[model samples]
Target: MAVLTSWVWLLAGCLSAAVAEDSNVSALYPPLWEESPEQISDYRLEDGKHIMDPWVITDRMGMYRILLKQTAPYFASYAPENEQNILWGLPLQFGWQYTTGRLADPTGMTDCGYEAGDTLCVSVDSWWADVNYYLSVLPFLAAVDSGILGIPSDQISILPPLKDQMMFCYTVSGCQSAFPEAMGRWSAFFQYMQSPSSDFDGLLEYLWAAHTSSLEYPTRAFVDRYAYYSDQEANFEKNWAIAVDYIAATRLPTTLSRVHSFQNGLPPRVLVDTDIAPYIADFTPLQNKVLVLLNVLGNIHHFTGSLFLTAWESAMSTKAARKLFLISFEKFLETSS
Candidate 1:
């Protein structure tokens, strides 16, 4: 009984440590960080155009930075410091991806995103970077179109990637033409953001609708890219994609604090073939268990239909209920084990 008590204490300590990590928010920023442009005037102008190259990691992040700054007024009434902005998740997640080397080329053929070559480079070969492009670049274009950026859509031009030029759309009109559903959804989100009636939950609903829609095409298009990564990384990518749908269905407001806490459960870096979760020194037992659960859920998602997800989405519709459900579920699983 004493030995069991000691183990319980250790587990509790580890969980406490994870919770404490939320205060170390600087870990969420990418390496070699610099202040990003908060407005269009900060960007370089080329022949009456605001020039942006979304292929660069910082440049891509700049888009989100600008977006949050522009949209802060809409969310100010909900909470102070723009902490209530649902859009915080996008830039925060992107920064986490970069800090963890998910933005690096996993193919080992290029040094794009490697500190030795070009630290700021966001490789087109990276599945994380490519999928993130849809999340970052598309919404940015839509913001311009919706007049949130205070610029005409055509006044801003995003540079294209080298190989997959045709896969991405550089201009608002081009994106609207190529990705009508995603563009429309994003435009609607901006419209709603500008609405006085938009509360936190309403913003979350609109934001997730647009966020999930933005992910649809890229997740399908980048299926082939997963082959370049390890089994663990590939599975993680799929799991994260499916998890978005689950979260979107809940309409949970992914505020800054909530997102930071939630990301603590995610793997800090791409898992290599040789890295065993149980023995990973940096991860606690709870984190290892979470990783294992992710793999199981990822596999189940692959082999099964959306019925389970639908049921889960229906059962836990609110953030408070979802939290209670998770706590109760964990307690049940622990007792059974």
Candidate 2:
């Protein structure tokens, strides 16, 4: 009986040891694996430059610099005719032809599909493309600011306002309440542009017309008419003051000081005295870059006005457009000097 009890105790000890071993194995191979070997291998390859020799890295960078230098002029031109063929030219041509009744009717109709005719179609497409081009360059400009050119990302908050304004213009439902479902916001914009006056006053006039034509009639008309002449005037003045304050805050001179400080921190081997001094001089690299960005923005703004006039006739939202206009004008004043 004593011998049997000893064997039972020994068996119990073995069972406990087996359970402990299983728990230890499970702890080592937990269910939540941190990363797969494949993911780790890919990360290492990208982060370590594929473990290439230093000479190979240098050679690749040098080749890239050479390519960028070679292509600089093409990009720098006011309008590269060669690139025009690829970017705006073909798209514009196709858009113009399709909308102008020169091509077969897109809807398979025998007659010109639109009562307003080819002009309206052309106008819509042109406006769409102009907006597209303006928005597309923004990312590239942001990349230049942060990556290659070394301008701090925080300094250039201008892009977001402009983007928001463009989006509001494209998608806002305020105009939809006036125009028919078929007409859409584009028609409202087109009508505004077609008006002889295309400024704030012009916008007021367009709003009045929309108000009168709307099914809501007297209520919408009365409200908008009074608001346009009175509230809008006060709003405009207030916005102008705010924009002036922003300009005072973000003006390029302040930014130049920041850029200078950043440049000062670089090792002597990486940058020379000549490079540093010239960057602060009249028409500095910083200035040149800002000028390029501003110039593009200004040109697009002006081009949009032109397209609006061509398509229907002119525009800006209250806050975004006003701020952009003030900033661009201020930069232009500095550039003129």
Candidate 1: which stretches are off by over 4 Å? Answer: 1-34, 317-337
Q: What are the lDDT figures for the candidates, one per model?
A: 0.75, 0.27
Residue 122 lDDT in model 1? 91
TM-score for each prediction? 0.85, 0.15
Pairs that clash in candidate 2: 193-313, 193-314, 194-312, 194-313, 308-313, 309-313
Task: Candidate 1: give its CA RMSD in angstroms.
Answer: 5.8
lDDT (tens digit, per residue) of candidate 1 on 214-322: 9999999989999998887787788778867765765655667656655665678788877676677787566676666556556655666866566556655667755
What's model 1's TM-score? 0.85
Error of 2 at 72 (Å): 2.9
Superposed on all Cα atoms, model 2 deviates from the true structure by an RMSD in Å of 32.7
